[model samples]
Target: MLHPEIQAKARAELEGVIGLDDNGHIPRLPDFEDRPKTPYLEYILLETTRWAPLSPLGVPHASTNADEYKGYYIPAGATVFANAYAMSRDERYYSSPEEFNPDRYIPVSEGGRGEPHPEGPFGFGRRVCPGQHLAMAGVWICIATLLATMELKCPVDEEGKELRPTVGFSDGLSGVPDAFGCRMVVREEAMELLGL
Candidate 1:
């Protein structure tokens, strides 16, 4: 993984929630039942969304009435785009806007210094993505399960040098990561947990 510390922290959290059984293996996979107690995992998911939001420019909305913002006048019915990307990395809200730090979402009581706020990668207002909740839930479950059962690392070339992926996204309405290479190895305990 690019950030081993964060991955280790998440795995540690998983261990605390669904610890080993008599055979010294993780007894079960993470589920909705464990979601409430896995705050750190939640932070990781949130950070993933913020770091590379799928939709940089949210769905366009038309102004119902004429309005003025920062000395700019907008006629009625003018289409307005919410730059979700800018908001996600706004220096005013995030301390290190460019860094991918999940701890930013962790509460102060939990030893993290992030300020609590309602902003998310999802679009805002009444027009916000209707499936945001469902999408987040799905992403959370997938990420948690994967991190619990495998190790992700940058791939290596035939010469044995590690391939460091360039952190860039394709230009489009949606900001998708450019082609990259990585390696995923199943954890030894994963098979046992899977009853394989």
Candidate 2:
């Protein structure tokens, strides 16, 4: 809701793939195989994770062998927590770390920066989240369906002004955002497809 431009761009990408009928009716919602045609969808997913990581402090990891590199003392066994939030916002890697821009994830060959995805969000090495792939697939499908069927907008007041929700997050292992109101209006094409 906060980023209509991004949504519109993604919608355009979808239309280019799925297309519309002569009466401008939606043919059908997108499927998993259409993922490649709409690369922006992946970018949006990546941007969401990069902007606000689910787990700010990644799962605690134990150091098998400790050593001093930055002049710190060495320890045999140590508990280390990677700061994913900090890593995502590193200015050296991100052009404007604070901005929620999805284009950063595009590959360099495609004229994008080819920036690396935030690794700490999932985890490192053999300890990575097992359901990461499934989670991405499910979320992508849900998002694509919604984008195809409806237009997401912020809830508005009677005064004709947008009621921007206070962006607050629950602090914990997973920093889930607090409730925010949005208005999802069914698209004209989708309504027509449903024989409305």
- The best candidate by TM-score is 1
Candidate 2 residue lDDT tens string, 1-196? 7889999999989988999989898898899989988899899999888889899988877778977858976576787878899999998998898898998988999999988877777877799899989988998999999999999998999997999777778988899899899899998989977677
What 10-residue stretch in candidate 2 is worst by lDDT?
72-81
Candidate 2 global Cα RMSD: 1.8
Candidate 1: which stretches are off by over 4 Å?
117-120
TM-score each candidate: 0.92, 0.91
lDDT of 2: 0.88
Candidate 1: count the clashes.
0
Off by over 4 Å in 2: 68-74
